[model samples]
Target: MDVVVGRVAKAHGIRGELAVDVRTDSPEARFALGSVLAAKLRDGTSRDLTVAAARYHSGRLLVRFEEVLTRDVAELLRGTLLLGSTDALPPTDDPDEFYDHQLEGLAAELADGTRIGTVKEIVHGPGGELLVLVREDGSEALVPFVRQIVPTVDVAGGRVVVDPPEGLLDAD
Candidate 1:
């Protein structure tokens, strides 16, 4: 499985440096020097890009790939999705921690085991992580992925126990 680690936001300066919007929690490891990432371009083709240099500037990650050496080349890479193989990822040591892929497609239910939905995906934003659920009615619900709301996650059992507050799962 290929997981998105970053997206090319734009070309930076006159060099081949690219400003990237990080999607992975471990950006340092994912964008480290010598790391090779699969770039899924807008044209549906994929290419391997080797990280030549990387740096943090003003809270954004700037990366220069070995295959790119000019601003024009970097500009062409804008909006490219940088992917890393899931097999290269190390398992999380913390019991409470989980990869987005692990939570997706799991059965979402209440504490009483009443099935409500299936986890569609995990949305990571500035506020926090949200559990996007595809409800029984085909509508979607965004549940905050905090310990208070999602009290239980049984990856092996293939389910998540959601303890949502009133009106949280209500249809508009």
Candidate 2:
């Protein structure tokens, strides 16, 4: 399965190298030479790109593709999503860890069978990951990643059951 690892932030220097806003545990460790990446371009097409070189510079992942060779080419790739196969990723050392890819589109519910919403996205912040849940009507809710709230996460069943406190989901 393709897992989103990063996004092409902007063009680095005059070269075709891209500065990626990494969203992984070890950014430098994820994108290695010869690694194949699927880039989701702005035109809604996916391109298979071979990693020529990947390194860390100025708190960002500097990535160069085999065919991308100029600022113009790299600029076109800006906002493009860098995706890699889950098999290529190293196993997580943390037991409680969950990948962002696994959380996307999962059903959100309560233990009592109250269907809350579907996970639209996971937002990483100072506290932790905030689950962005989108209801059927297109309204969104931000649920804290606390155990008291999100008591269960069933990736296999594609669901995350939450037990939100009073006024939690009640908030606009």
Can you give the TM-score per candidate against the true fold?
0.88, 0.81
Query: Model 2 off-target regions past 4 Å?
Result: 23-29, 56-59, 90-95
**Local accuracy of candidate 2 as per-residue lDDT tens digits, 1-172:** 8777889999998879999887655456568788778999989999988889988786567999997999999999999998888787667787567878778899999999789899988876657779999986789999987778898888889899999888888845
lDDT of 2 at 26: 47
Model 1 local distance difference test score: 0.93
The lDDT for every candidate, in the order shown, is: 0.93, 0.84
Cα misplacement distance, residue 57 of candidate 1 (Å): 2.6
After superposition, the stretches of candidate 1 with alpha carbons farther than 4 Å from their true spots are none
